[model samples]
Target: MMISNTPPPPYYAVIFTSVRTNDNEGYAETDALMSELALQQDGFLGMEHASSEIGITISYWRDVESIKHWKDNLDHQKAQIKGQKTWYSQYKVRIAKVERDYDFLKK
Candidate 1:
C-alpha cells in the first residue's frame, strides 16, 4: 500500500505492532475484513502497514472518540479476540497524537 495522505498535524494514530504465530488459520481474510471495516468508520482517515517477522500497522483517525468507537465495534472486538487466541504471538498497541509530520518524495 502507498503512504496514507493524512491531513496536517493534530490527528490521532493507533499504532499496532505485532509478531505472528505459526498458525495461518484465516488470518489474512480477517485482516482484510478489518481493513475494510475500519475504512467504513466515521473518523478513519487512513492506514499503513508492513510486515516481516513482525508487523506494524498505523491507523490514522480524526479524534480519540473515533478511535474509541472503532475499538468498541462488535466485529472488531471479535477480531481482537481471534488475534489473541490465534494469529498473534505477541502484540502492542500505542495511541499517540501527531502534532507534526513531514515527508519527502523523489522525482
Candidate 2:
C-alpha cells in the first residue's frame, strides 16, 4: 500500500498491530469492508497497512472524536469480536497524537 497523504501533523492515528492465528475465514473480506467503511466515516483522514509475521495498520483521523466514532461503529465492533474469538492470536491497539512528521519522494 502507498503512504497516506495527510494534511499535517495534528491528526490522530489508531495503530493496530496483530499476529494472526492462521484462520483466514472471513478475514480478507471483512478487512476490505472495514477499510471502505472507514473512508465513509466523518473524520477519517487516511490509512496505511502491512502484514507479515507481525501486522500493522495505521488509520489516520481528524481528531479524538473521529477515532471514538470509529471505535463505536457496530460493524467494526463486530469485527473486533470476531478477531478476538477467531482471527488473531494476539493484537494491540494504540492511539497517538501526531506532533511532527516528514517525508520526501524522488522526482
Candidate 3:
C-alpha cells in the first residue's frame, strides 16, 4: 500500500542514483515494467524523486531480503543490464537503514 505518512524507524531504504547514457533503447517499456514490479512487491513503500539524465529514487523495503529479491528478479536484472549498456552511463546504489528520520510537510 502507498503510505504518504512517514515510515517507522529502522526501515531500509535503497537509494538508486543514475546518470543516463545518450543511447536509450526500449527504455519506456522497461521502465514501465520496473514500476509494475515495484507495485507487485509487498515491501514497496513508495518512491520520491525527479528523473531525467540524472535521477534519484528511494525505494523503501521491509528488510534486506526484500531488497535482494528485487535485485535478483529476472526483469529487474535485465533492466539493470540494459541500464549499464544503454540507459545509464553510470549509477550508484546505496542501501541504508533509517536510524532516525526528520521531516516537515506543508499541508
Best prediction by lDDT = 1
TM for candidate 2 is: 0.97
The 10-residue segment with the lowest total lDDT in model 3:
1-10
Each prediction's TM-score against the native?
A: 0.98, 0.97, 0.85
Q: After superposition, how far is residue 21 of candidate 1 from its true place, in Å?
A: 0.3
Candidate 1 error regions (>4 Å) = none
Each model's number of backbone clashes?
0, 0, 0
Is candidate 1 or 2 superior in lDDT? Answer: 1
Clashing pairs in 3: none
Whole-model lDDT, model 1: 0.97
Considering summed lDDT, which 10 consecutive residues are worst modelled in model 2? 1-10
Task: Decide which is better by TM-score, 1 or 3.
Answer: 1
- Report how far residue 71 has shifted in candidate 2, in Å: 0.4
lDDT of candidate model 3 versus the reference? 0.80
Candidate 3 matches the true fold with a TM-score of 0.85
Can you give the lDDT of residue 103 in candidate 2? 97
After the best TM-score superposition of candidate 2, give how far the Cα of residue 21 lies from its true spot, in angstroms: 0.5
* Per-candidate local distance difference test: 0.97, 0.95, 0.80
Per-residue CA lDDT of candidate 3, range 29-75, in tens?
A: 98878988986887776666668768888887878898888898898
